[model samples]
Target: MSLSETQPDAAGARRIARPVPLRESVYSAILDMIVSRNLQPGQHLVESELALMLGVSRQPVREALQWLKNDGWVDLRPGLGAYVHTPTVEEADQLLAVRRLLETESARLAAQHATEEGVEHLRELCRQGFAALEAEDVATMVALNAELHATVMRLSRNDVLVELASQVDRRVRWYYTPVARHRGAQSWTEHSALIDAIAAGDGDRAGEVMHAHTEHTRLSYLEQQNLEKSGADAGSPARPITGRRP
Candidate 1:
């Protein structure tokens, strides 16, 4: 029998259903691997192995690796394939500094320009974030956390500011994914304060709160690092932060 004639229509239908778009699928797969710590910083990405694991062609994997390189999540090395990028303490500090400046300005603008509808949306986002936290849905909480920040940036209505904030948001997420569980209720409490400030339309207060929040994140990261180092010195397992799957 011919191949077509041997196969039932339903069987063929299942096999011929379109696959996910190559670029997007590969991007998401690699991102998830990175977030989950399956691809640790400085770990090499072997194209053939990744292609086999992802069940796709090397072309798509290569394209995704290039995109990740541009995002500062991977480093492309000549003859050595791509390696995951690690943020140094210095780099983290610099990023947090920039984030504080940009986000605080964004919050100030959001307070001034956010319409009633925008404020309501922000409130809903905060509510959902807290609910997710209460339920111990770390993934949902992380997603909502990004949504809340993005919504505020949109309300700001400054294209340049929004773009900067978007970049910072990605880095911030990478930082948070590892530490979200440890942060626990404190994170949501800060979000509540931020929401209250924004809802009150107090631009100066909103900016101040945002600035403090960013600084608080920086401090927490620093403390975590210190704790890890101390633990190592004391001969305990160096509980390094572990990221979530994307």
Candidate 2:
């Protein structure tokens, strides 16, 4: 349970402040690790280890695991304990398809309402993204990519769209991480075109560019998954589809 303190202010309005629940914080930490693949999919989750890793107690870890299970982030077995949920190909495809729809609409709206500042912000991000790419900084590149898309969503001025995008943000990042490097130059190039369309206030062209941009990513992810499956079937060692940072 979460506790908060309420006090009267000068105008008699109440101000309440409370720290986040420990279980909730633990849940977020574990969820992030899972999303980053630090806790690989299907990896067994040891409550004690998690407690130790997070500097918390077993009770909180246990609570967090249950919450994670409720959220489809983990699976609790009858006797085998908890494990990270391994998403199926269908799960990935469905999620990406939804993203494409939401983001395409966001792009169109952003073009309609984009300010000079917003477009410039996107250009700055693209510049940083290109720098990250050239330096082989995979983590920065992934983060900037996410930021750029999120910026576009915000520029749309559609609260519901932004909230919807936030809901799948983690999973989208999880899937994108494996293809970030593979998408590389071409991905940023698409972003430049998207920026141009939005900057020009060309809603139709912006939607078209964003549609192709997101679709390209979707296809790239699917292709990588297929390649990995083939390689696995051929008795070859698994390879990282997105090459590691140099």
Those runs of model 1 whose alpha carbons end farther than 4 Å from true positions after fitting are 1-25, 35-38, 76-81, 232-240, 243-246
List where candidate 2 sits over 4 angstroms from the true fold: 1-14, 240-246
Predicted structure 1, TM vs. truth: 0.79
**Candidate-wise lDDT, in order:** 0.81, 0.91
| Cα lDDT tens digits for candidate 1, 55-83 | 99999999999999998889998877799
Write model 2 residue lDDT over 1-246, tens digit each, in one string.
Answer: 323333325334445667999999999999988876678777899999999999999999999999999999999999899999978889999999999999999999999999999999999999999999999888788889999999999999999999999999988998998889889999999999999999999999999999999999999989988998899899998764332563
RMSD of each: 8.7, 3.9
User: Against the true structure, what is each candidate's TM-score?
Assistant: 0.79, 0.91
Best by lDDT: 2
